[model samples]
Target: RKGGAEMTQREFKDMPSRIARLPRDKRGFPIPKFVGAVDKKGEPDFRLVSHDHMAACVRRNLCWICGDVMGTRKAFALGPMCCINRVSSEPPSHYECAVFAAKACPFLSNPNAKRRQRDLPEAGEVAGIMIERNPGVTAIWVTRFYSLMQVSNGVLFFVGEPEGLEFYARGRAATRAEIKASIASGIPHLEEVAKRDGRGAMSELKRMRKRFDALLADRVPA
Candidate 1:
């Protein structure tokens, strides 16, 4: 009986790791680290989701942005993208955070920065950054799981699937409209940053405004 129990324990321990290896929807990108909870010291760790945390977040239905427990299973999966490539690998944030991030994130707001190629010295445009959602993604996946171990330094180490195996889809058109409105409302904040950071920030905002205007122009019935 003891041997059987030990075998069961081993299987249980291995179950999540096994499930973590399963394939996920590649169309949905991983959650970005910036969307995670800050540490006790108020610093963002920028760590990817472990299988354990993924399971915890799903089981608890926590909001990635506010670290608050959510009341419902339905949540928004926000993908921070530079053109087709995903830039973040965290988890599902609150609907509000998704809208705020889409509008306020510097990478998303600034067309040049979104498309800038870090690999090249000249910093040329490579892609446009945006928050994208596929109309097809309708649910979150939580079949996979992970385990956690706390080390001596008080840091928790995620042992499996830190890149995340679960996914969420972007919100609806109303949500997109809210994001655009938030961006428009944030213009003052951009100007404040320019005031504090000087020419660099000013130039960046100018470029973003130009890009935003161009985007608006493209949407017109021309």
Candidate 2:
């Protein structure tokens, strides 16, 4: 955020309400509360998440995007892989904030968008298995039950069963065809994991497939 300009109220009016509440970074992008560290030159890196900030969100029921108090139902704007596993590396946020992020973030909104490969130790160490690739499809997974589960050196949020589910691709509601395409594109990674983890993992994959199909069956729900 070193060179970032202060966002004006006028600019806020041009953006979504929840998004306008966020402070902008040097790149003119709204800085999410979940962002934790900066690059070597002290520029904030959107890719990194701060564990302290994450914990605070869970402890206070604060929205990760806007850093505001949240309602009882917390929403997670997650990638397709996270949807299947019900694991989020970040905390929950207000529905509007999460949806705005799901649509506005280049990495989440664009299937063709690629994550930059970088090593920023200042961002701190992360726990659990990381999926370096973007999930392509974003799911607004909503629930009232979620808990922080500490991993070896970091933490993760284990989302309870979704009370509401919706899918987005390229910023708008995703069609069943699009969801299926996303699943097809992403399932290979799961298959590879199952191949390495063996029969038990394979069984889980079968169940995951069922879940995936069930979501597709609804196709964003009327």
Predicted structure with the largest lDDT when compared to the true one: 2
lDDT of 2 by residue, 45-164 (tens): 887887677778877888888888888899998777778877888888888787877777879989889877668563444567766676668899989998778887678888987888
**Top candidate (TM-score):** 2
TM-score of each: 0.28, 0.85
Candidate 2 Cα errors over 4 Å, as ranges: 1-18, 122-126, 219-222
Candidate 2: how large is its RMSD?
3.8
lDDT of 2 at 81: 79
The residue-by-residue lDDT of candidate 1 on 1-222, one tens digit each, is 585653222111112222223232222222342223434465432332234555466557665544555553323433211101111234455444444444433343333343323232322211222232222222121212323343442222112221222222232223334334444554555566567988887887777577544543443232
- Give me the displacement of residue 165 in model 1, in angstroms: 23
